[model samples]
Target: MKYIKGIFWLMAIACVIYAGYTLHSCRQRLANNPMGLELGFQKEINQTPVVLQSIERIGQWEFLSIDDEVMVDTTESHLLSPDDHLVRIYHGTLRLGIDFSLCDRGWATASGDTVSLRLPPIQLLDRNFIDEARTRSFYEYGTWNVQAKEDMYNRARTRMIQRAMTPQNIKQAEDNARHQVEALFRSLGYRVVRITVGRSS
Candidate 1:
Protein backbone atom coordinates (compact mmCIF):
# COMPACT_ATOMS: atom_id res chain seq x y z
CA MET A 1 0.00 0.00 0.00
CA LYS A 2 2.84 2.40 0.82
CA TYR A 3 4.49 1.75 -2.55
CA ILE A 4 1.18 2.32 -4.30
CA LYS A 5 0.74 5.67 -2.54
CA GLY A 6 4.31 6.67 -3.49
CA ILE A 7 3.60 5.88 -7.18
CA PHE A 8 0.41 8.00 -7.14
CA TRP A 9 2.33 10.98 -5.68
CA LEU A 10 5.06 10.60 -8.30
CA MET A 11 2.46 10.59 -11.08
CA ALA A 12 0.84 13.73 -9.68
CA ILE A 13 4.20 15.53 -9.53
CA ALA A 14 5.00 14.51 -13.16
CA CYS A 15 1.59 15.77 -14.31
CA VAL A 16 2.15 19.10 -12.56
CA ILE A 17 5.60 19.47 -14.22
CA TYR A 18 4.13 18.72 -17.64
CA ALA A 19 1.35 21.28 -17.12
CA GLY A 20 3.91 23.96 -16.14
CA TYR A 21 5.97 23.27 -19.26
CA THR A 22 2.91 23.49 -21.50
CA LEU A 23 1.88 26.79 -19.97
CA HIS A 24 5.36 28.25 -20.51
CA SER A 25 5.34 27.19 -24.17
CA CYS A 26 1.93 28.75 -24.70
CA ARG A 27 3.13 32.06 -23.24
CA GLN A 28 6.23 32.03 -25.45
CA ARG A 29 4.20 31.52 -28.61
CA LEU A 30 1.80 34.30 -27.66
CA ALA A 31 4.74 36.65 -27.21
CA ASN A 32 6.11 35.77 -30.64
CA ASN A 33 2.75 36.26 -32.43
CA PRO A 34 1.92 39.59 -34.02
CA MET A 35 -0.35 42.03 -32.18
CA GLY A 36 -3.24 40.91 -34.46
CA LEU A 37 -3.51 44.32 -36.17
CA GLU A 38 -4.40 44.39 -39.85
CA LEU A 39 -1.53 44.93 -42.29
CA GLY A 40 -1.71 47.42 -45.21
CA PHE A 41 -2.76 50.26 -42.87
CA GLN A 42 0.36 52.28 -43.73
CA LYS A 43 0.17 51.44 -47.44
CA GLU A 44 -3.26 53.03 -47.63
CA ILE A 45 -1.81 56.21 -46.19
CA ASN A 46 1.04 56.35 -48.75
CA GLN A 47 -1.38 55.91 -51.65
CA THR A 48 -2.81 59.41 -51.20
CA PRO A 49 -2.09 61.61 -54.26
CA VAL A 50 0.88 63.63 -53.07
CA VAL A 51 3.33 65.21 -55.53
CA LEU A 52 6.64 63.38 -56.13
CA GLN A 53 9.85 64.63 -57.80
CA SER A 54 12.33 62.11 -59.17
CA ILE A 55 15.65 62.15 -61.09
CA GLU A 56 16.84 59.58 -63.57
CA ARG A 57 20.32 58.71 -64.86
CA ILE A 58 20.32 58.73 -68.67
CA GLY A 59 23.99 58.36 -69.66
CA GLN A 60 27.47 57.32 -68.54
CA TRP A 61 30.89 57.24 -70.25
CA GLU A 62 34.67 57.11 -69.75
CA PHE A 63 36.49 60.19 -68.41
CA LEU A 64 38.16 61.36 -71.60
CA SER A 65 37.49 65.11 -71.29
CA ILE A 66 35.40 67.53 -69.24
CA ASP A 67 33.36 68.86 -72.15
CA ASP A 68 31.62 65.57 -72.71
CA GLU A 69 27.88 65.76 -72.01
CA VAL A 70 27.45 62.76 -69.78
CA MET A 71 23.78 63.58 -69.27
CA VAL A 72 22.98 63.40 -72.93
CA ASP A 73 19.59 61.70 -72.46
CA THR A 74 17.90 63.35 -69.49
CA THR A 75 15.58 66.28 -68.65
CA GLU A 76 14.18 68.04 -65.56
CA SER A 77 10.82 69.44 -64.45
CA HIS A 78 9.12 70.83 -61.32
CA LEU A 79 7.20 68.03 -59.64
CA LEU A 80 4.54 69.72 -57.53
CA SER A 81 3.44 73.08 -56.09
CA PRO A 82 2.01 72.90 -52.61
CA ASP A 83 -1.20 74.72 -51.69
CA ASP A 84 -1.30 74.18 -47.93
CA HIS A 85 0.92 72.41 -45.38
CA LEU A 86 1.06 69.29 -47.54
CA VAL A 87 4.09 67.02 -47.96
CA ARG A 88 6.06 66.54 -51.20
CA ILE A 89 8.35 63.68 -52.25
CA TYR A 90 11.44 63.52 -54.49
CA HIS A 91 13.63 60.57 -55.52
CA GLY A 92 16.70 60.03 -57.76
CA THR A 93 19.56 57.62 -58.48
CA LEU A 94 23.28 58.05 -59.32
CA ARG A 95 25.05 56.05 -62.08
CA LEU A 96 28.83 55.68 -62.47
CA GLY A 97 31.69 53.41 -63.70
CA ILE A 98 35.49 52.90 -63.53
CA ASP A 99 38.44 52.79 -66.06
CA PHE A 100 41.95 51.38 -65.77
CA SER A 101 45.43 51.29 -67.43
CA LEU A 102 48.49 49.04 -67.17
CA CYS A 103 52.24 49.75 -67.32
CA ASP A 104 55.04 47.27 -68.08
CA ARG A 105 58.78 47.60 -67.32
CA GLY A 106 61.06 45.85 -69.83
CA TRP A 107 63.21 43.05 -68.40
CA ALA A 108 63.68 44.26 -64.83
CA THR A 109 66.55 42.45 -63.20
CA ALA A 110 65.08 42.30 -59.69
CA SER A 111 61.36 41.70 -60.08
CA GLY A 112 61.05 40.78 -63.80
CA ASP A 113 57.34 41.73 -63.80
CA THR A 114 54.78 44.40 -64.68
CA VAL A 115 52.60 46.73 -62.62
CA SER A 116 48.98 47.81 -63.19
CA LEU A 117 47.00 50.84 -61.97
CA ARG A 118 43.40 51.86 -62.30
CA LEU A 119 41.48 55.14 -62.52
CA PRO A 120 38.06 55.33 -60.89
CA PRO A 121 35.08 56.16 -63.01
CA ILE A 122 34.08 59.75 -63.46
CA GLN A 123 30.79 60.17 -61.56
CA LEU A 124 27.94 60.88 -64.01
CA LEU A 125 25.03 61.57 -61.74
CA ASP A 126 22.40 64.06 -62.94
CA ARG A 127 19.53 65.74 -61.07
CA ASN A 128 16.02 66.48 -62.35
CA PHE A 129 12.44 66.82 -61.08
CA ILE A 130 9.22 65.45 -62.57
CA ASP A 131 6.10 67.47 -61.72
CA GLU A 132 2.88 65.44 -61.73
CA ALA A 133 0.25 67.83 -60.41
CA ARG A 134 -2.16 69.87 -62.57
CA THR A 135 -1.00 73.46 -62.96
CA ARG A 136 -2.86 76.15 -61.03
CA SER A 137 -2.69 79.96 -61.11
CA PHE A 138 -2.10 82.30 -58.18
CA TYR A 139 -5.18 83.85 -56.62
CA GLU A 140 -6.00 87.41 -57.75
CA TYR A 141 -5.70 90.15 -55.09
CA GLY A 142 -9.23 91.47 -55.76
CA THR A 143 -10.93 88.06 -55.90
CA TRP A 144 -9.76 86.99 -52.48
CA ASN A 145 -9.43 89.97 -50.11
CA VAL A 146 -6.00 91.63 -50.44
CA GLN A 147 -4.80 90.36 -47.10
CA ALA A 148 -6.03 86.84 -47.84
CA LYS A 149 -4.37 86.82 -51.25
CA GLU A 150 -1.13 88.06 -49.76
CA ASP A 151 -1.19 85.30 -47.18
CA MET A 152 -1.91 82.69 -49.86
CA TYR A 153 0.91 84.00 -52.04
CA ASN A 154 3.32 83.88 -49.16
CA ARG A 155 2.38 80.28 -48.36
CA ALA A 156 2.75 79.27 -52.01
CA ARG A 157 6.13 80.93 -52.21
CA THR A 158 7.33 79.00 -49.17
CA ARG A 159 6.16 75.75 -50.75
CA MET A 160 7.98 76.58 -53.96
CA ILE A 161 11.19 77.18 -52.04
CA GLN A 162 10.81 73.85 -50.31
CA ARG A 163 10.20 72.13 -53.65
CA ALA A 164 13.29 73.76 -55.16
CA MET A 165 15.45 72.55 -52.27
CA THR A 166 14.72 68.90 -53.12
CA PRO A 167 17.35 68.80 -55.84
CA GLN A 168 19.91 70.36 -53.53
CA ASN A 169 19.19 67.66 -51.01
CA ILE A 170 19.77 65.04 -53.67
CA LYS A 171 23.00 66.73 -54.69
CA GLN A 172 24.36 66.74 -51.14
CA ALA A 173 23.34 63.13 -50.53
CA GLU A 174 24.93 61.95 -53.81
CA ASP A 175 28.08 63.90 -53.01
CA ASN A 176 28.38 62.20 -49.65
CA ALA A 177 27.76 58.77 -51.15
CA ARG A 178 30.36 59.39 -53.84
CA HIS A 179 32.88 60.53 -51.26
CA GLN A 180 32.34 57.40 -49.24
CA VAL A 181 32.71 55.22 -52.31
CA GLU A 182 35.92 57.03 -53.25
CA ALA A 183 37.28 56.55 -49.78
CA LEU A 184 36.46 52.87 -49.99
CA PHE A 185 38.34 52.59 -53.31
CA ARG A 186 41.31 54.48 -51.90
CA SER A 187 41.44 52.06 -49.02
CA LEU A 188 41.53 49.30 -51.63
CA GLY A 189 44.50 50.99 -53.46
CA TYR A 190 42.58 52.43 -56.41
CA ARG A 191 43.17 56.09 -57.34
CA VAL A 192 40.18 58.36 -57.96
CA VAL A 193 41.06 60.11 -61.19
CA ARG A 194 38.23 62.63 -61.46
CA ILE A 195 34.68 63.52 -60.49
CA THR A 196 32.47 65.27 -63.02
CA VAL A 197 28.89 66.56 -62.93
CA GLY A 198 27.13 65.87 -66.16
CA ARG A 199 24.27 67.93 -67.60
CA SER A 200 21.08 67.97 -65.58
CA SER A 201 18.76 65.31 -66.83
Candidate 2:
Protein backbone atom coordinates (compact mmCIF):
# COMPACT_ATOMS: atom_id res chain seq x y z
CA MET A 1 0.00 0.00 0.00
CA LYS A 2 2.86 2.42 0.87
CA TYR A 3 4.66 1.77 -2.48
CA ILE A 4 1.45 2.23 -4.46
CA LYS A 5 0.77 5.59 -2.77
CA GLY A 6 4.33 6.80 -3.46
CA ILE A 7 4.08 5.88 -7.18
CA PHE A 8 0.74 7.68 -7.45
CA TRP A 9 2.21 10.86 -5.93
CA LEU A 10 5.25 10.71 -8.25
CA MET A 11 3.00 10.38 -11.31
CA ALA A 12 0.89 13.32 -10.17
CA ILE A 13 4.03 15.48 -9.73
CA ALA A 14 5.31 14.52 -13.21
CA CYS A 15 1.97 15.47 -14.81
CA VAL A 16 2.00 18.89 -13.13
CA ILE A 17 5.56 19.59 -14.25
CA TYR A 18 4.79 18.51 -17.86
CA ALA A 19 1.69 20.74 -17.95
CA GLY A 20 3.73 23.78 -16.78
CA TYR A 21 6.38 23.18 -19.44
CA THR A 22 3.77 22.91 -22.19
CA LEU A 23 2.15 26.16 -21.07
CA HIS A 24 5.50 27.99 -21.02
CA SER A 25 6.35 26.78 -24.53
CA CYS A 26 2.98 27.96 -25.83
CA ARG A 27 3.53 31.44 -24.32
CA GLN A 28 7.07 31.70 -25.77
CA ARG A 29 5.89 30.76 -29.29
CA LEU A 30 2.99 33.22 -29.00
CA ALA A 31 5.40 35.98 -27.96
CA ASN A 32 7.52 35.31 -31.04
CA ASN A 33 4.46 35.68 -33.35
CA PRO A 34 2.88 39.08 -34.05
CA MET A 35 -0.74 37.80 -34.50
CA GLY A 36 -0.24 34.88 -32.06
CA LEU A 37 -2.30 32.59 -34.29
CA GLU A 38 -1.08 29.03 -33.86
CA LEU A 39 -2.08 27.82 -37.36
CA GLY A 40 -1.20 31.15 -39.10
CA PHE A 41 -4.84 31.35 -40.28
CA GLN A 42 -7.88 32.81 -38.56
CA LYS A 43 -11.35 31.46 -39.24
CA GLU A 44 -13.68 33.93 -40.91
CA ILE A 45 -16.26 34.92 -38.37
CA ASN A 46 -19.67 35.57 -39.98
CA GLN A 47 -21.71 38.05 -37.93
CA THR A 48 -24.64 38.58 -40.30
CA PRO A 49 -26.97 36.25 -38.47
CA VAL A 50 -26.14 37.80 -35.12
CA VAL A 51 -26.59 41.33 -36.46
CA LEU A 52 -29.94 40.52 -38.06
CA GLN A 53 -31.17 38.95 -34.85
CA SER A 54 -30.19 41.98 -32.83
CA ILE A 55 -31.70 44.51 -35.23
CA GLU A 56 -35.39 45.49 -35.18
CA ARG A 57 -36.85 48.31 -37.27
CA ILE A 58 -34.57 50.63 -39.26
CA GLY A 59 -34.93 53.84 -41.32
CA GLN A 60 -37.87 55.32 -39.47
CA TRP A 61 -39.56 58.28 -41.22
CA GLU A 62 -42.43 60.24 -39.67
CA PHE A 63 -42.48 63.68 -41.21
CA LEU A 64 -45.67 63.56 -43.26
CA SER A 65 -48.94 64.62 -41.65
CA ILE A 66 -52.53 65.26 -42.75
CA ASP A 67 -55.31 67.37 -41.40
CA ASP A 68 -58.58 65.53 -42.11
CA GLU A 69 -61.95 67.08 -41.43
CA VAL A 70 -64.92 64.83 -40.63
CA MET A 71 -68.43 66.23 -40.93
CA VAL A 72 -71.43 64.48 -39.39
CA ASP A 73 -74.99 65.70 -39.89
CA THR A 74 -77.71 65.42 -37.28
CA THR A 75 -80.72 63.08 -37.66
CA GLU A 76 -83.01 65.33 -35.69
CA SER A 77 -85.92 67.25 -37.22
CA HIS A 78 -85.16 70.32 -39.33
CA LEU A 79 -87.86 72.33 -37.43
CA LEU A 80 -85.97 72.10 -34.15
CA SER A 81 -82.67 73.37 -35.57
CA PRO A 82 -81.68 75.00 -38.82
CA ASP A 83 -78.40 73.07 -39.21
CA ASP A 84 -76.82 70.67 -36.77
CA HIS A 85 -73.46 69.06 -37.56
CA LEU A 86 -70.22 67.95 -35.91
CA VAL A 87 -66.93 69.01 -37.43
CA ARG A 88 -63.64 67.65 -36.17
CA ILE A 89 -60.12 68.03 -37.53
CA TYR A 90 -58.02 64.85 -37.20
CA HIS A 91 -54.32 65.58 -37.13
CA GLY A 92 -52.53 62.35 -37.97
CA THR A 93 -48.85 61.67 -38.50
CA LEU A 94 -47.69 58.85 -40.81
CA ARG A 95 -44.67 56.83 -39.78
CA LEU A 96 -43.06 54.33 -42.14
CA GLY A 97 -40.00 52.11 -41.80
CA ILE A 98 -38.49 48.67 -42.44
CA ASP A 99 -39.39 45.89 -40.05
CA PHE A 100 -36.35 43.73 -39.40
CA SER A 101 -38.40 41.14 -37.58
CA LEU A 102 -39.66 39.98 -40.97
CA CYS A 103 -36.07 39.44 -42.10
CA ASP A 104 -36.09 35.79 -41.19
CA ARG A 105 -34.43 34.12 -44.20
CA GLY A 106 -31.99 35.20 -46.94
CA TRP A 107 -31.52 38.64 -45.48
CA ALA A 108 -27.74 38.72 -45.32
CA THR A 109 -24.65 36.85 -46.45
CA ALA A 110 -20.90 37.27 -46.20
CA SER A 111 -18.08 35.80 -48.29
CA GLY A 112 -14.42 36.72 -47.86
CA ASP A 113 -14.33 40.52 -47.43
CA THR A 114 -17.62 41.07 -49.26
CA VAL A 115 -21.04 41.23 -47.67
CA SER A 116 -24.45 40.96 -49.35
CA LEU A 117 -27.40 42.41 -47.48
CA ARG A 118 -31.07 42.35 -48.44
CA LEU A 119 -33.37 44.72 -46.59
CA PRO A 120 -37.00 43.96 -45.80
CA PRO A 121 -39.96 45.90 -47.21
CA ILE A 122 -41.09 49.22 -45.81
CA GLN A 123 -44.43 49.38 -44.01
CA LEU A 124 -46.44 51.34 -41.47
CA LEU A 125 -44.78 51.00 -38.09
CA ASP A 126 -47.60 52.08 -35.83
CA ARG A 127 -51.18 50.79 -35.69
CA ASN A 128 -52.72 53.64 -33.71
CA PHE A 129 -51.61 56.68 -35.70
CA ILE A 130 -54.49 58.99 -34.96
CA ASP A 131 -54.87 60.22 -31.41
CA GLU A 132 -58.58 60.79 -30.93
CA ALA A 133 -58.08 62.55 -27.62
CA ARG A 134 -55.70 64.97 -29.29
CA THR A 135 -58.17 65.63 -32.16
CA ARG A 136 -59.46 69.19 -32.11
CA SER A 137 -63.14 69.98 -32.45
CA PHE A 138 -63.30 72.74 -35.03
CA TYR A 139 -67.07 73.11 -34.74
CA GLU A 140 -69.68 71.03 -33.00
CA TYR A 141 -73.36 71.91 -33.30
CA GLY A 142 -74.69 68.56 -32.08
CA THR A 143 -73.57 65.42 -30.23
CA TRP A 144 -71.64 62.87 -32.35
CA ASN A 145 -72.16 59.13 -31.91
CA VAL A 146 -69.28 56.74 -31.05
CA GLN A 147 -69.54 54.77 -34.31
CA ALA A 148 -69.30 57.90 -36.45
CA LYS A 149 -66.19 59.08 -34.67
CA GLU A 150 -64.56 55.68 -35.05
CA ASP A 151 -65.35 55.64 -38.76
CA MET A 152 -63.87 59.09 -39.16
CA TYR A 153 -60.68 58.03 -37.41
CA ASN A 154 -60.37 55.00 -39.68
CA ARG A 155 -60.86 57.11 -42.78
CA ALA A 156 -58.28 59.63 -41.66
CA ARG A 157 -55.76 56.90 -40.94
CA THR A 158 -56.29 55.29 -44.37
CA ARG A 159 -55.92 58.61 -46.18
CA MET A 160 -52.79 59.53 -44.24
CA ILE A 161 -51.21 56.17 -45.06
CA GLN A 162 -52.14 56.40 -48.72
CA ARG A 163 -50.75 59.90 -49.11
CA ALA A 164 -47.51 59.17 -47.25
CA MET A 165 -46.53 55.72 -48.57
CA THR A 166 -45.27 56.64 -52.02
CA PRO A 167 -42.76 54.99 -54.32
CA GLN A 168 -40.25 57.81 -53.89
CA ASN A 169 -40.48 57.58 -50.11
CA ILE A 170 -39.97 53.81 -50.14
CA LYS A 171 -36.94 54.17 -52.36
CA GLN A 172 -35.52 56.78 -50.03
CA ALA A 173 -35.96 54.47 -47.08
CA GLU A 174 -34.22 51.67 -48.96
CA ASP A 175 -31.32 53.95 -49.79
CA ASN A 176 -30.98 54.95 -46.17
CA ALA A 177 -31.04 51.31 -45.12
CA ARG A 178 -28.30 50.46 -47.60
CA HIS A 179 -26.06 53.26 -46.37
CA GLN A 180 -26.49 52.30 -42.74
CA VAL A 181 -25.91 48.59 -43.35
CA GLU A 182 -22.88 49.23 -45.55
CA ALA A 183 -21.37 51.34 -42.82
CA LEU A 184 -21.97 48.56 -40.34
CA PHE A 185 -20.30 45.98 -42.59
CA ARG A 186 -17.34 48.29 -43.15
CA SER A 187 -16.98 48.67 -39.44
CA LEU A 188 -16.89 44.88 -39.22
CA GLY A 189 -13.88 44.75 -41.58
CA TYR A 190 -15.88 44.12 -44.76
CA ARG A 191 -14.27 45.70 -47.83
CA VAL A 192 -17.26 45.61 -50.19
CA VAL A 193 -20.98 45.55 -49.38
CA ARG A 194 -23.77 44.82 -51.84
CA ILE A 195 -27.35 45.82 -51.01
CA THR A 196 -30.52 44.32 -52.48
CA VAL A 197 -33.87 46.04 -52.09
CA GLY A 198 -37.25 44.60 -53.06
CA ARG A 199 -40.29 46.28 -54.55
CA SER A 200 -41.88 47.45 -51.32
CA SER A 201 -38.52 48.47 -49.87
Candidate 3:
Protein backbone atom coordinates (compact mmCIF):
# COMPACT_ATOMS: atom_id res chain seq x y z
CA MET A 1 0.00 0.00 0.00
CA LYS A 2 2.87 2.39 0.89
CA TYR A 3 4.60 1.74 -2.46
CA ILE A 4 1.35 2.32 -4.41
CA LYS A 5 0.74 5.61 -2.58
CA GLY A 6 4.31 6.70 -3.33
CA ILE A 7 3.87 6.01 -7.06
CA PHE A 8 0.57 7.96 -7.23
CA TRP A 9 2.13 10.98 -5.46
CA LEU A 10 5.17 10.84 -7.78
CA MET A 11 2.89 10.86 -10.87
CA ALA A 12 0.86 13.80 -9.53
CA ILE A 13 4.04 15.84 -8.85
CA ALA A 14 5.39 15.07 -12.33
CA CYS A 15 2.08 16.23 -13.94
CA VAL A 16 2.12 19.50 -11.99
CA ILE A 17 5.77 20.18 -12.96
CA TYR A 18 5.02 19.47 -16.64
CA ALA A 19 2.01 21.77 -16.57
CA GLY A 20 4.08 24.61 -15.03
CA TYR A 21 6.84 24.15 -17.61
CA THR A 22 4.31 24.24 -20.49
CA LEU A 23 2.66 27.40 -19.14
CA HIS A 24 6.02 29.12 -18.67
CA SER A 25 7.11 28.20 -22.18
CA CYS A 26 3.88 29.52 -23.62
CA ARG A 27 4.28 32.83 -21.82
CA GLN A 28 7.91 33.20 -22.90
CA ARG A 29 6.98 32.50 -26.50
CA LEU A 30 4.11 34.93 -26.31
CA ALA A 31 6.48 37.63 -25.10
CA ASN A 32 8.84 36.94 -28.00
CA ASN A 33 6.05 36.77 -30.61
CA PRO A 34 3.31 39.33 -30.13
CA MET A 35 1.00 37.08 -32.13
CA GLY A 36 1.03 34.68 -29.14
CA LEU A 37 1.40 31.57 -31.27
CA GLU A 38 3.43 28.87 -29.56
CA LEU A 39 5.95 26.62 -31.35
CA GLY A 40 3.83 23.45 -31.30
CA PHE A 41 0.61 25.31 -32.06
CA GLN A 42 -0.19 25.75 -35.72
CA LYS A 43 -2.56 28.41 -37.04
CA GLU A 44 -4.85 27.41 -39.84
CA ILE A 45 -3.04 27.90 -43.14
CA ASN A 46 -6.25 27.85 -45.22
CA GLN A 47 -8.41 30.67 -43.87
CA THR A 48 -10.86 30.38 -46.76
CA PRO A 49 -13.10 27.96 -44.97
CA VAL A 50 -13.02 30.02 -41.82
CA VAL A 51 -13.74 33.25 -43.66
CA LEU A 52 -16.49 31.73 -45.77
CA GLN A 53 -18.13 30.20 -42.78
CA SER A 54 -17.96 33.45 -40.90
CA ILE A 55 -19.51 35.38 -43.77
CA GLU A 56 -22.27 32.84 -44.24
CA ARG A 57 -23.02 32.93 -40.55
CA ILE A 58 -23.53 36.66 -40.85
CA GLY A 59 -26.17 35.94 -43.54
CA GLN A 60 -27.39 39.21 -45.12
CA TRP A 61 -24.87 41.74 -43.97
CA GLU A 62 -26.22 45.23 -44.60
CA PHE A 63 -23.65 47.94 -45.29
CA LEU A 64 -25.77 50.85 -46.42
CA SER A 65 -29.32 51.97 -45.69
CA ILE A 66 -31.30 54.61 -47.59
CA ASP A 67 -34.57 56.12 -46.54
CA ASP A 68 -36.69 57.78 -49.17
CA GLU A 69 -40.18 59.16 -49.72
CA VAL A 70 -41.96 59.48 -53.04
CA MET A 71 -45.14 61.17 -54.17
CA VAL A 72 -47.21 59.42 -56.85
CA ASP A 73 -50.36 60.70 -58.43
CA THR A 74 -52.77 59.53 -61.11
CA THR A 75 -55.85 60.98 -62.85
CA GLU A 76 -58.74 59.22 -64.55
CA SER A 77 -61.10 61.23 -66.77
CA HIS A 78 -64.70 60.19 -67.50
CA LEU A 79 -66.81 61.28 -70.52
CA LEU A 80 -69.98 62.18 -68.57
CA SER A 81 -68.52 62.57 -65.07
CA PRO A 82 -65.84 64.52 -63.27
CA ASP A 83 -62.21 63.36 -63.40
CA ASP A 84 -60.92 61.16 -60.58
CA HIS A 85 -57.51 62.02 -59.19
CA LEU A 86 -55.45 60.38 -56.48
CA VAL A 87 -52.11 61.29 -55.00
CA ARG A 88 -50.19 59.35 -52.36
CA ILE A 89 -46.85 59.64 -50.61
CA TYR A 90 -44.85 56.50 -49.91
CA HIS A 91 -42.06 55.94 -47.40
CA GLY A 92 -39.51 53.17 -47.60
CA THR A 93 -36.04 52.13 -46.50
CA LEU A 94 -33.60 50.39 -48.79
CA ARG A 95 -30.86 48.17 -47.40
CA LEU A 96 -27.85 47.35 -49.53
CA GLY A 97 -25.43 44.49 -48.89
CA ILE A 98 -24.10 41.14 -50.05
CA ASP A 99 -25.92 37.86 -49.48
CA PHE A 100 -23.44 35.16 -48.57
CA SER A 101 -25.82 32.42 -49.68
CA LEU A 102 -25.17 33.51 -53.28
CA CYS A 103 -21.41 33.01 -52.94
CA ASP A 104 -19.77 30.36 -55.11
CA ARG A 105 -17.64 27.50 -53.82
CA GLY A 106 -14.44 29.20 -54.95
CA TRP A 107 -15.40 32.56 -53.54
CA ALA A 108 -12.58 32.61 -51.01
CA THR A 109 -8.99 31.43 -51.17
CA ALA A 110 -6.06 31.69 -48.78
CA SER A 111 -2.31 31.59 -49.35
CA GLY A 112 -0.35 31.52 -46.13
CA ASP A 113 -1.29 34.61 -44.12
CA THR A 114 -3.04 36.28 -47.04
CA VAL A 115 -6.67 35.71 -47.98
CA SER A 116 -8.62 36.78 -51.05
CA LEU A 117 -12.38 36.81 -51.36
CA ARG A 118 -14.67 37.31 -54.35
CA LEU A 119 -18.02 38.47 -53.10
CA PRO A 120 -21.26 39.46 -54.71
CA PRO A 121 -21.71 43.13 -55.52
CA ILE A 122 -23.81 45.31 -53.27
CA GLN A 123 -27.45 45.69 -54.18
CA LEU A 124 -30.87 46.24 -52.68
CA LEU A 125 -31.36 43.54 -50.09
CA ASP A 126 -35.14 43.55 -50.26
CA ARG A 127 -37.28 44.47 -53.22
CA ASN A 128 -40.44 44.98 -51.20
CA PHE A 129 -39.05 47.80 -49.08
CA ILE A 130 -42.08 50.03 -49.22
CA ASP A 131 -44.14 50.50 -46.09
CA GLU A 132 -47.73 50.32 -47.27
CA ALA A 133 -49.08 51.22 -43.86
CA ARG A 134 -46.97 54.34 -43.78
CA THR A 135 -48.31 55.49 -47.18
CA ARG A 136 -50.46 58.59 -46.79
CA SER A 137 -53.10 59.74 -49.23
CA PHE A 138 -52.08 63.28 -50.01
CA TYR A 139 -55.05 64.07 -52.23
CA GLU A 140 -58.14 62.27 -53.47
CA TYR A 141 -60.91 63.32 -55.83
CA GLY A 142 -63.89 61.16 -56.80
CA THR A 143 -63.85 57.36 -56.43
CA TRP A 144 -60.64 55.45 -57.26
CA ASN A 145 -60.53 51.76 -58.26
CA VAL A 146 -58.20 49.17 -56.73
CA GLN A 147 -56.19 48.91 -59.95
CA ALA A 148 -55.56 52.65 -59.97
CA LYS A 149 -54.32 52.51 -56.36
CA GLU A 150 -52.01 49.63 -57.27
CA ASP A 151 -50.66 51.57 -60.24
CA MET A 152 -49.89 54.54 -58.06
CA TYR A 153 -48.15 52.28 -55.55
CA ASN A 154 -46.06 50.77 -58.30
CA ARG A 155 -45.11 54.20 -59.57
CA ALA A 156 -44.03 55.17 -56.08
CA ARG A 157 -41.91 52.04 -55.78
CA THR A 158 -40.23 52.68 -59.12
CA ARG A 159 -39.53 56.29 -58.28
CA MET A 160 -38.06 55.29 -54.93
CA ILE A 161 -35.74 52.76 -56.53
CA GLN A 162 -34.58 55.23 -59.14
CA ARG A 163 -33.80 57.83 -56.51
CA ALA A 164 -32.16 55.56 -53.96
CA MET A 165 -30.29 53.06 -56.16
CA THR A 166 -27.92 55.56 -57.70
CA PRO A 167 -24.44 54.58 -58.85
CA GLN A 168 -22.87 56.65 -56.10
CA ASN A 169 -24.93 54.87 -53.43
CA ILE A 170 -23.98 51.44 -54.77
CA LYS A 171 -20.32 52.38 -54.85
CA GLN A 172 -20.51 53.66 -51.29
CA ALA A 173 -22.08 50.41 -50.18
CA GLU A 174 -19.33 48.44 -51.89
CA ASP A 175 -16.67 50.47 -50.16
CA ASN A 176 -18.31 49.84 -46.80
CA ALA A 177 -18.47 46.11 -47.52
CA ARG A 178 -14.76 46.02 -48.35
CA HIS A 179 -13.82 47.89 -45.22
CA GLN A 180 -15.90 45.61 -43.00
CA VAL A 181 -14.63 42.39 -44.63
CA GLU A 182 -11.02 43.47 -44.29
CA ALA A 183 -11.57 44.26 -40.66
CA LEU A 184 -13.17 40.87 -40.08
CA PHE A 185 -10.22 39.01 -41.63
CA ARG A 186 -7.76 41.07 -39.68
CA SER A 187 -9.56 40.12 -36.49
CA LEU A 188 -9.08 36.48 -37.55
CA GLY A 189 -5.30 37.05 -37.61
CA TYR A 190 -4.92 37.42 -41.36
CA ARG A 191 -2.00 39.62 -42.34
CA VAL A 192 -3.41 40.65 -45.71
CA VAL A 193 -6.97 40.52 -47.00
CA ARG A 194 -7.93 41.17 -50.62
CA ILE A 195 -11.56 41.48 -51.62
CA THR A 196 -13.18 41.78 -55.02
CA VAL A 197 -16.77 42.79 -55.64
CA GLY A 198 -18.11 41.00 -58.67
CA ARG A 199 -21.41 39.88 -60.13
CA SER A 200 -23.78 38.02 -57.87
CA SER A 201 -23.37 34.27 -58.01
Q: Please provide, for model 3 over 1-201, each residue's C-alpha lDDT reduced to its tens digit, 9 standing for 90 to 100.
A: 999999999999999999999999888878877575436766667555534344334578899999999888898889999888888899999999988887889899999999999998787888899999899999999998889888888888888888888888888998999999999999998999999997532
lDDT digits (tens) for residues 18-133 of candidate 1: 99999888877877887444556454335567666887543333221111111111112334842332122322223333222211232111112222223333333333222223
Clash pairs detected, candidate 1: 75-201, 79-131
Candidate 3 backbone clash number:
0
Better of 1 and 3 by TM-score: 3
Superposition TM-score, candidate 1 onto the true structure: 0.21
Q: Which ten residues in a row have the lowest lDDT in candidate 2?
A: 63-72
Instruction: Quantify all predictions' global Cα lDDT against the true fold.
Output: 0.40, 0.69, 0.88
Displacement of residue 142 (Cα, Å) in model 1 is 33
lDDT of 2 by residue, 1-201 (tens): 999999999999999999999999989887977855456566886666534457554544332233443432334336766655766677665666666676759688889999888766767677777767777876777666788778767777777677667787666766776777778889999999998765662
Clashes (backbone N, CA, C under 3 Å), per candidate, total 2, 0, 0
| 1 against 2, candidate with superior TM-score | 2
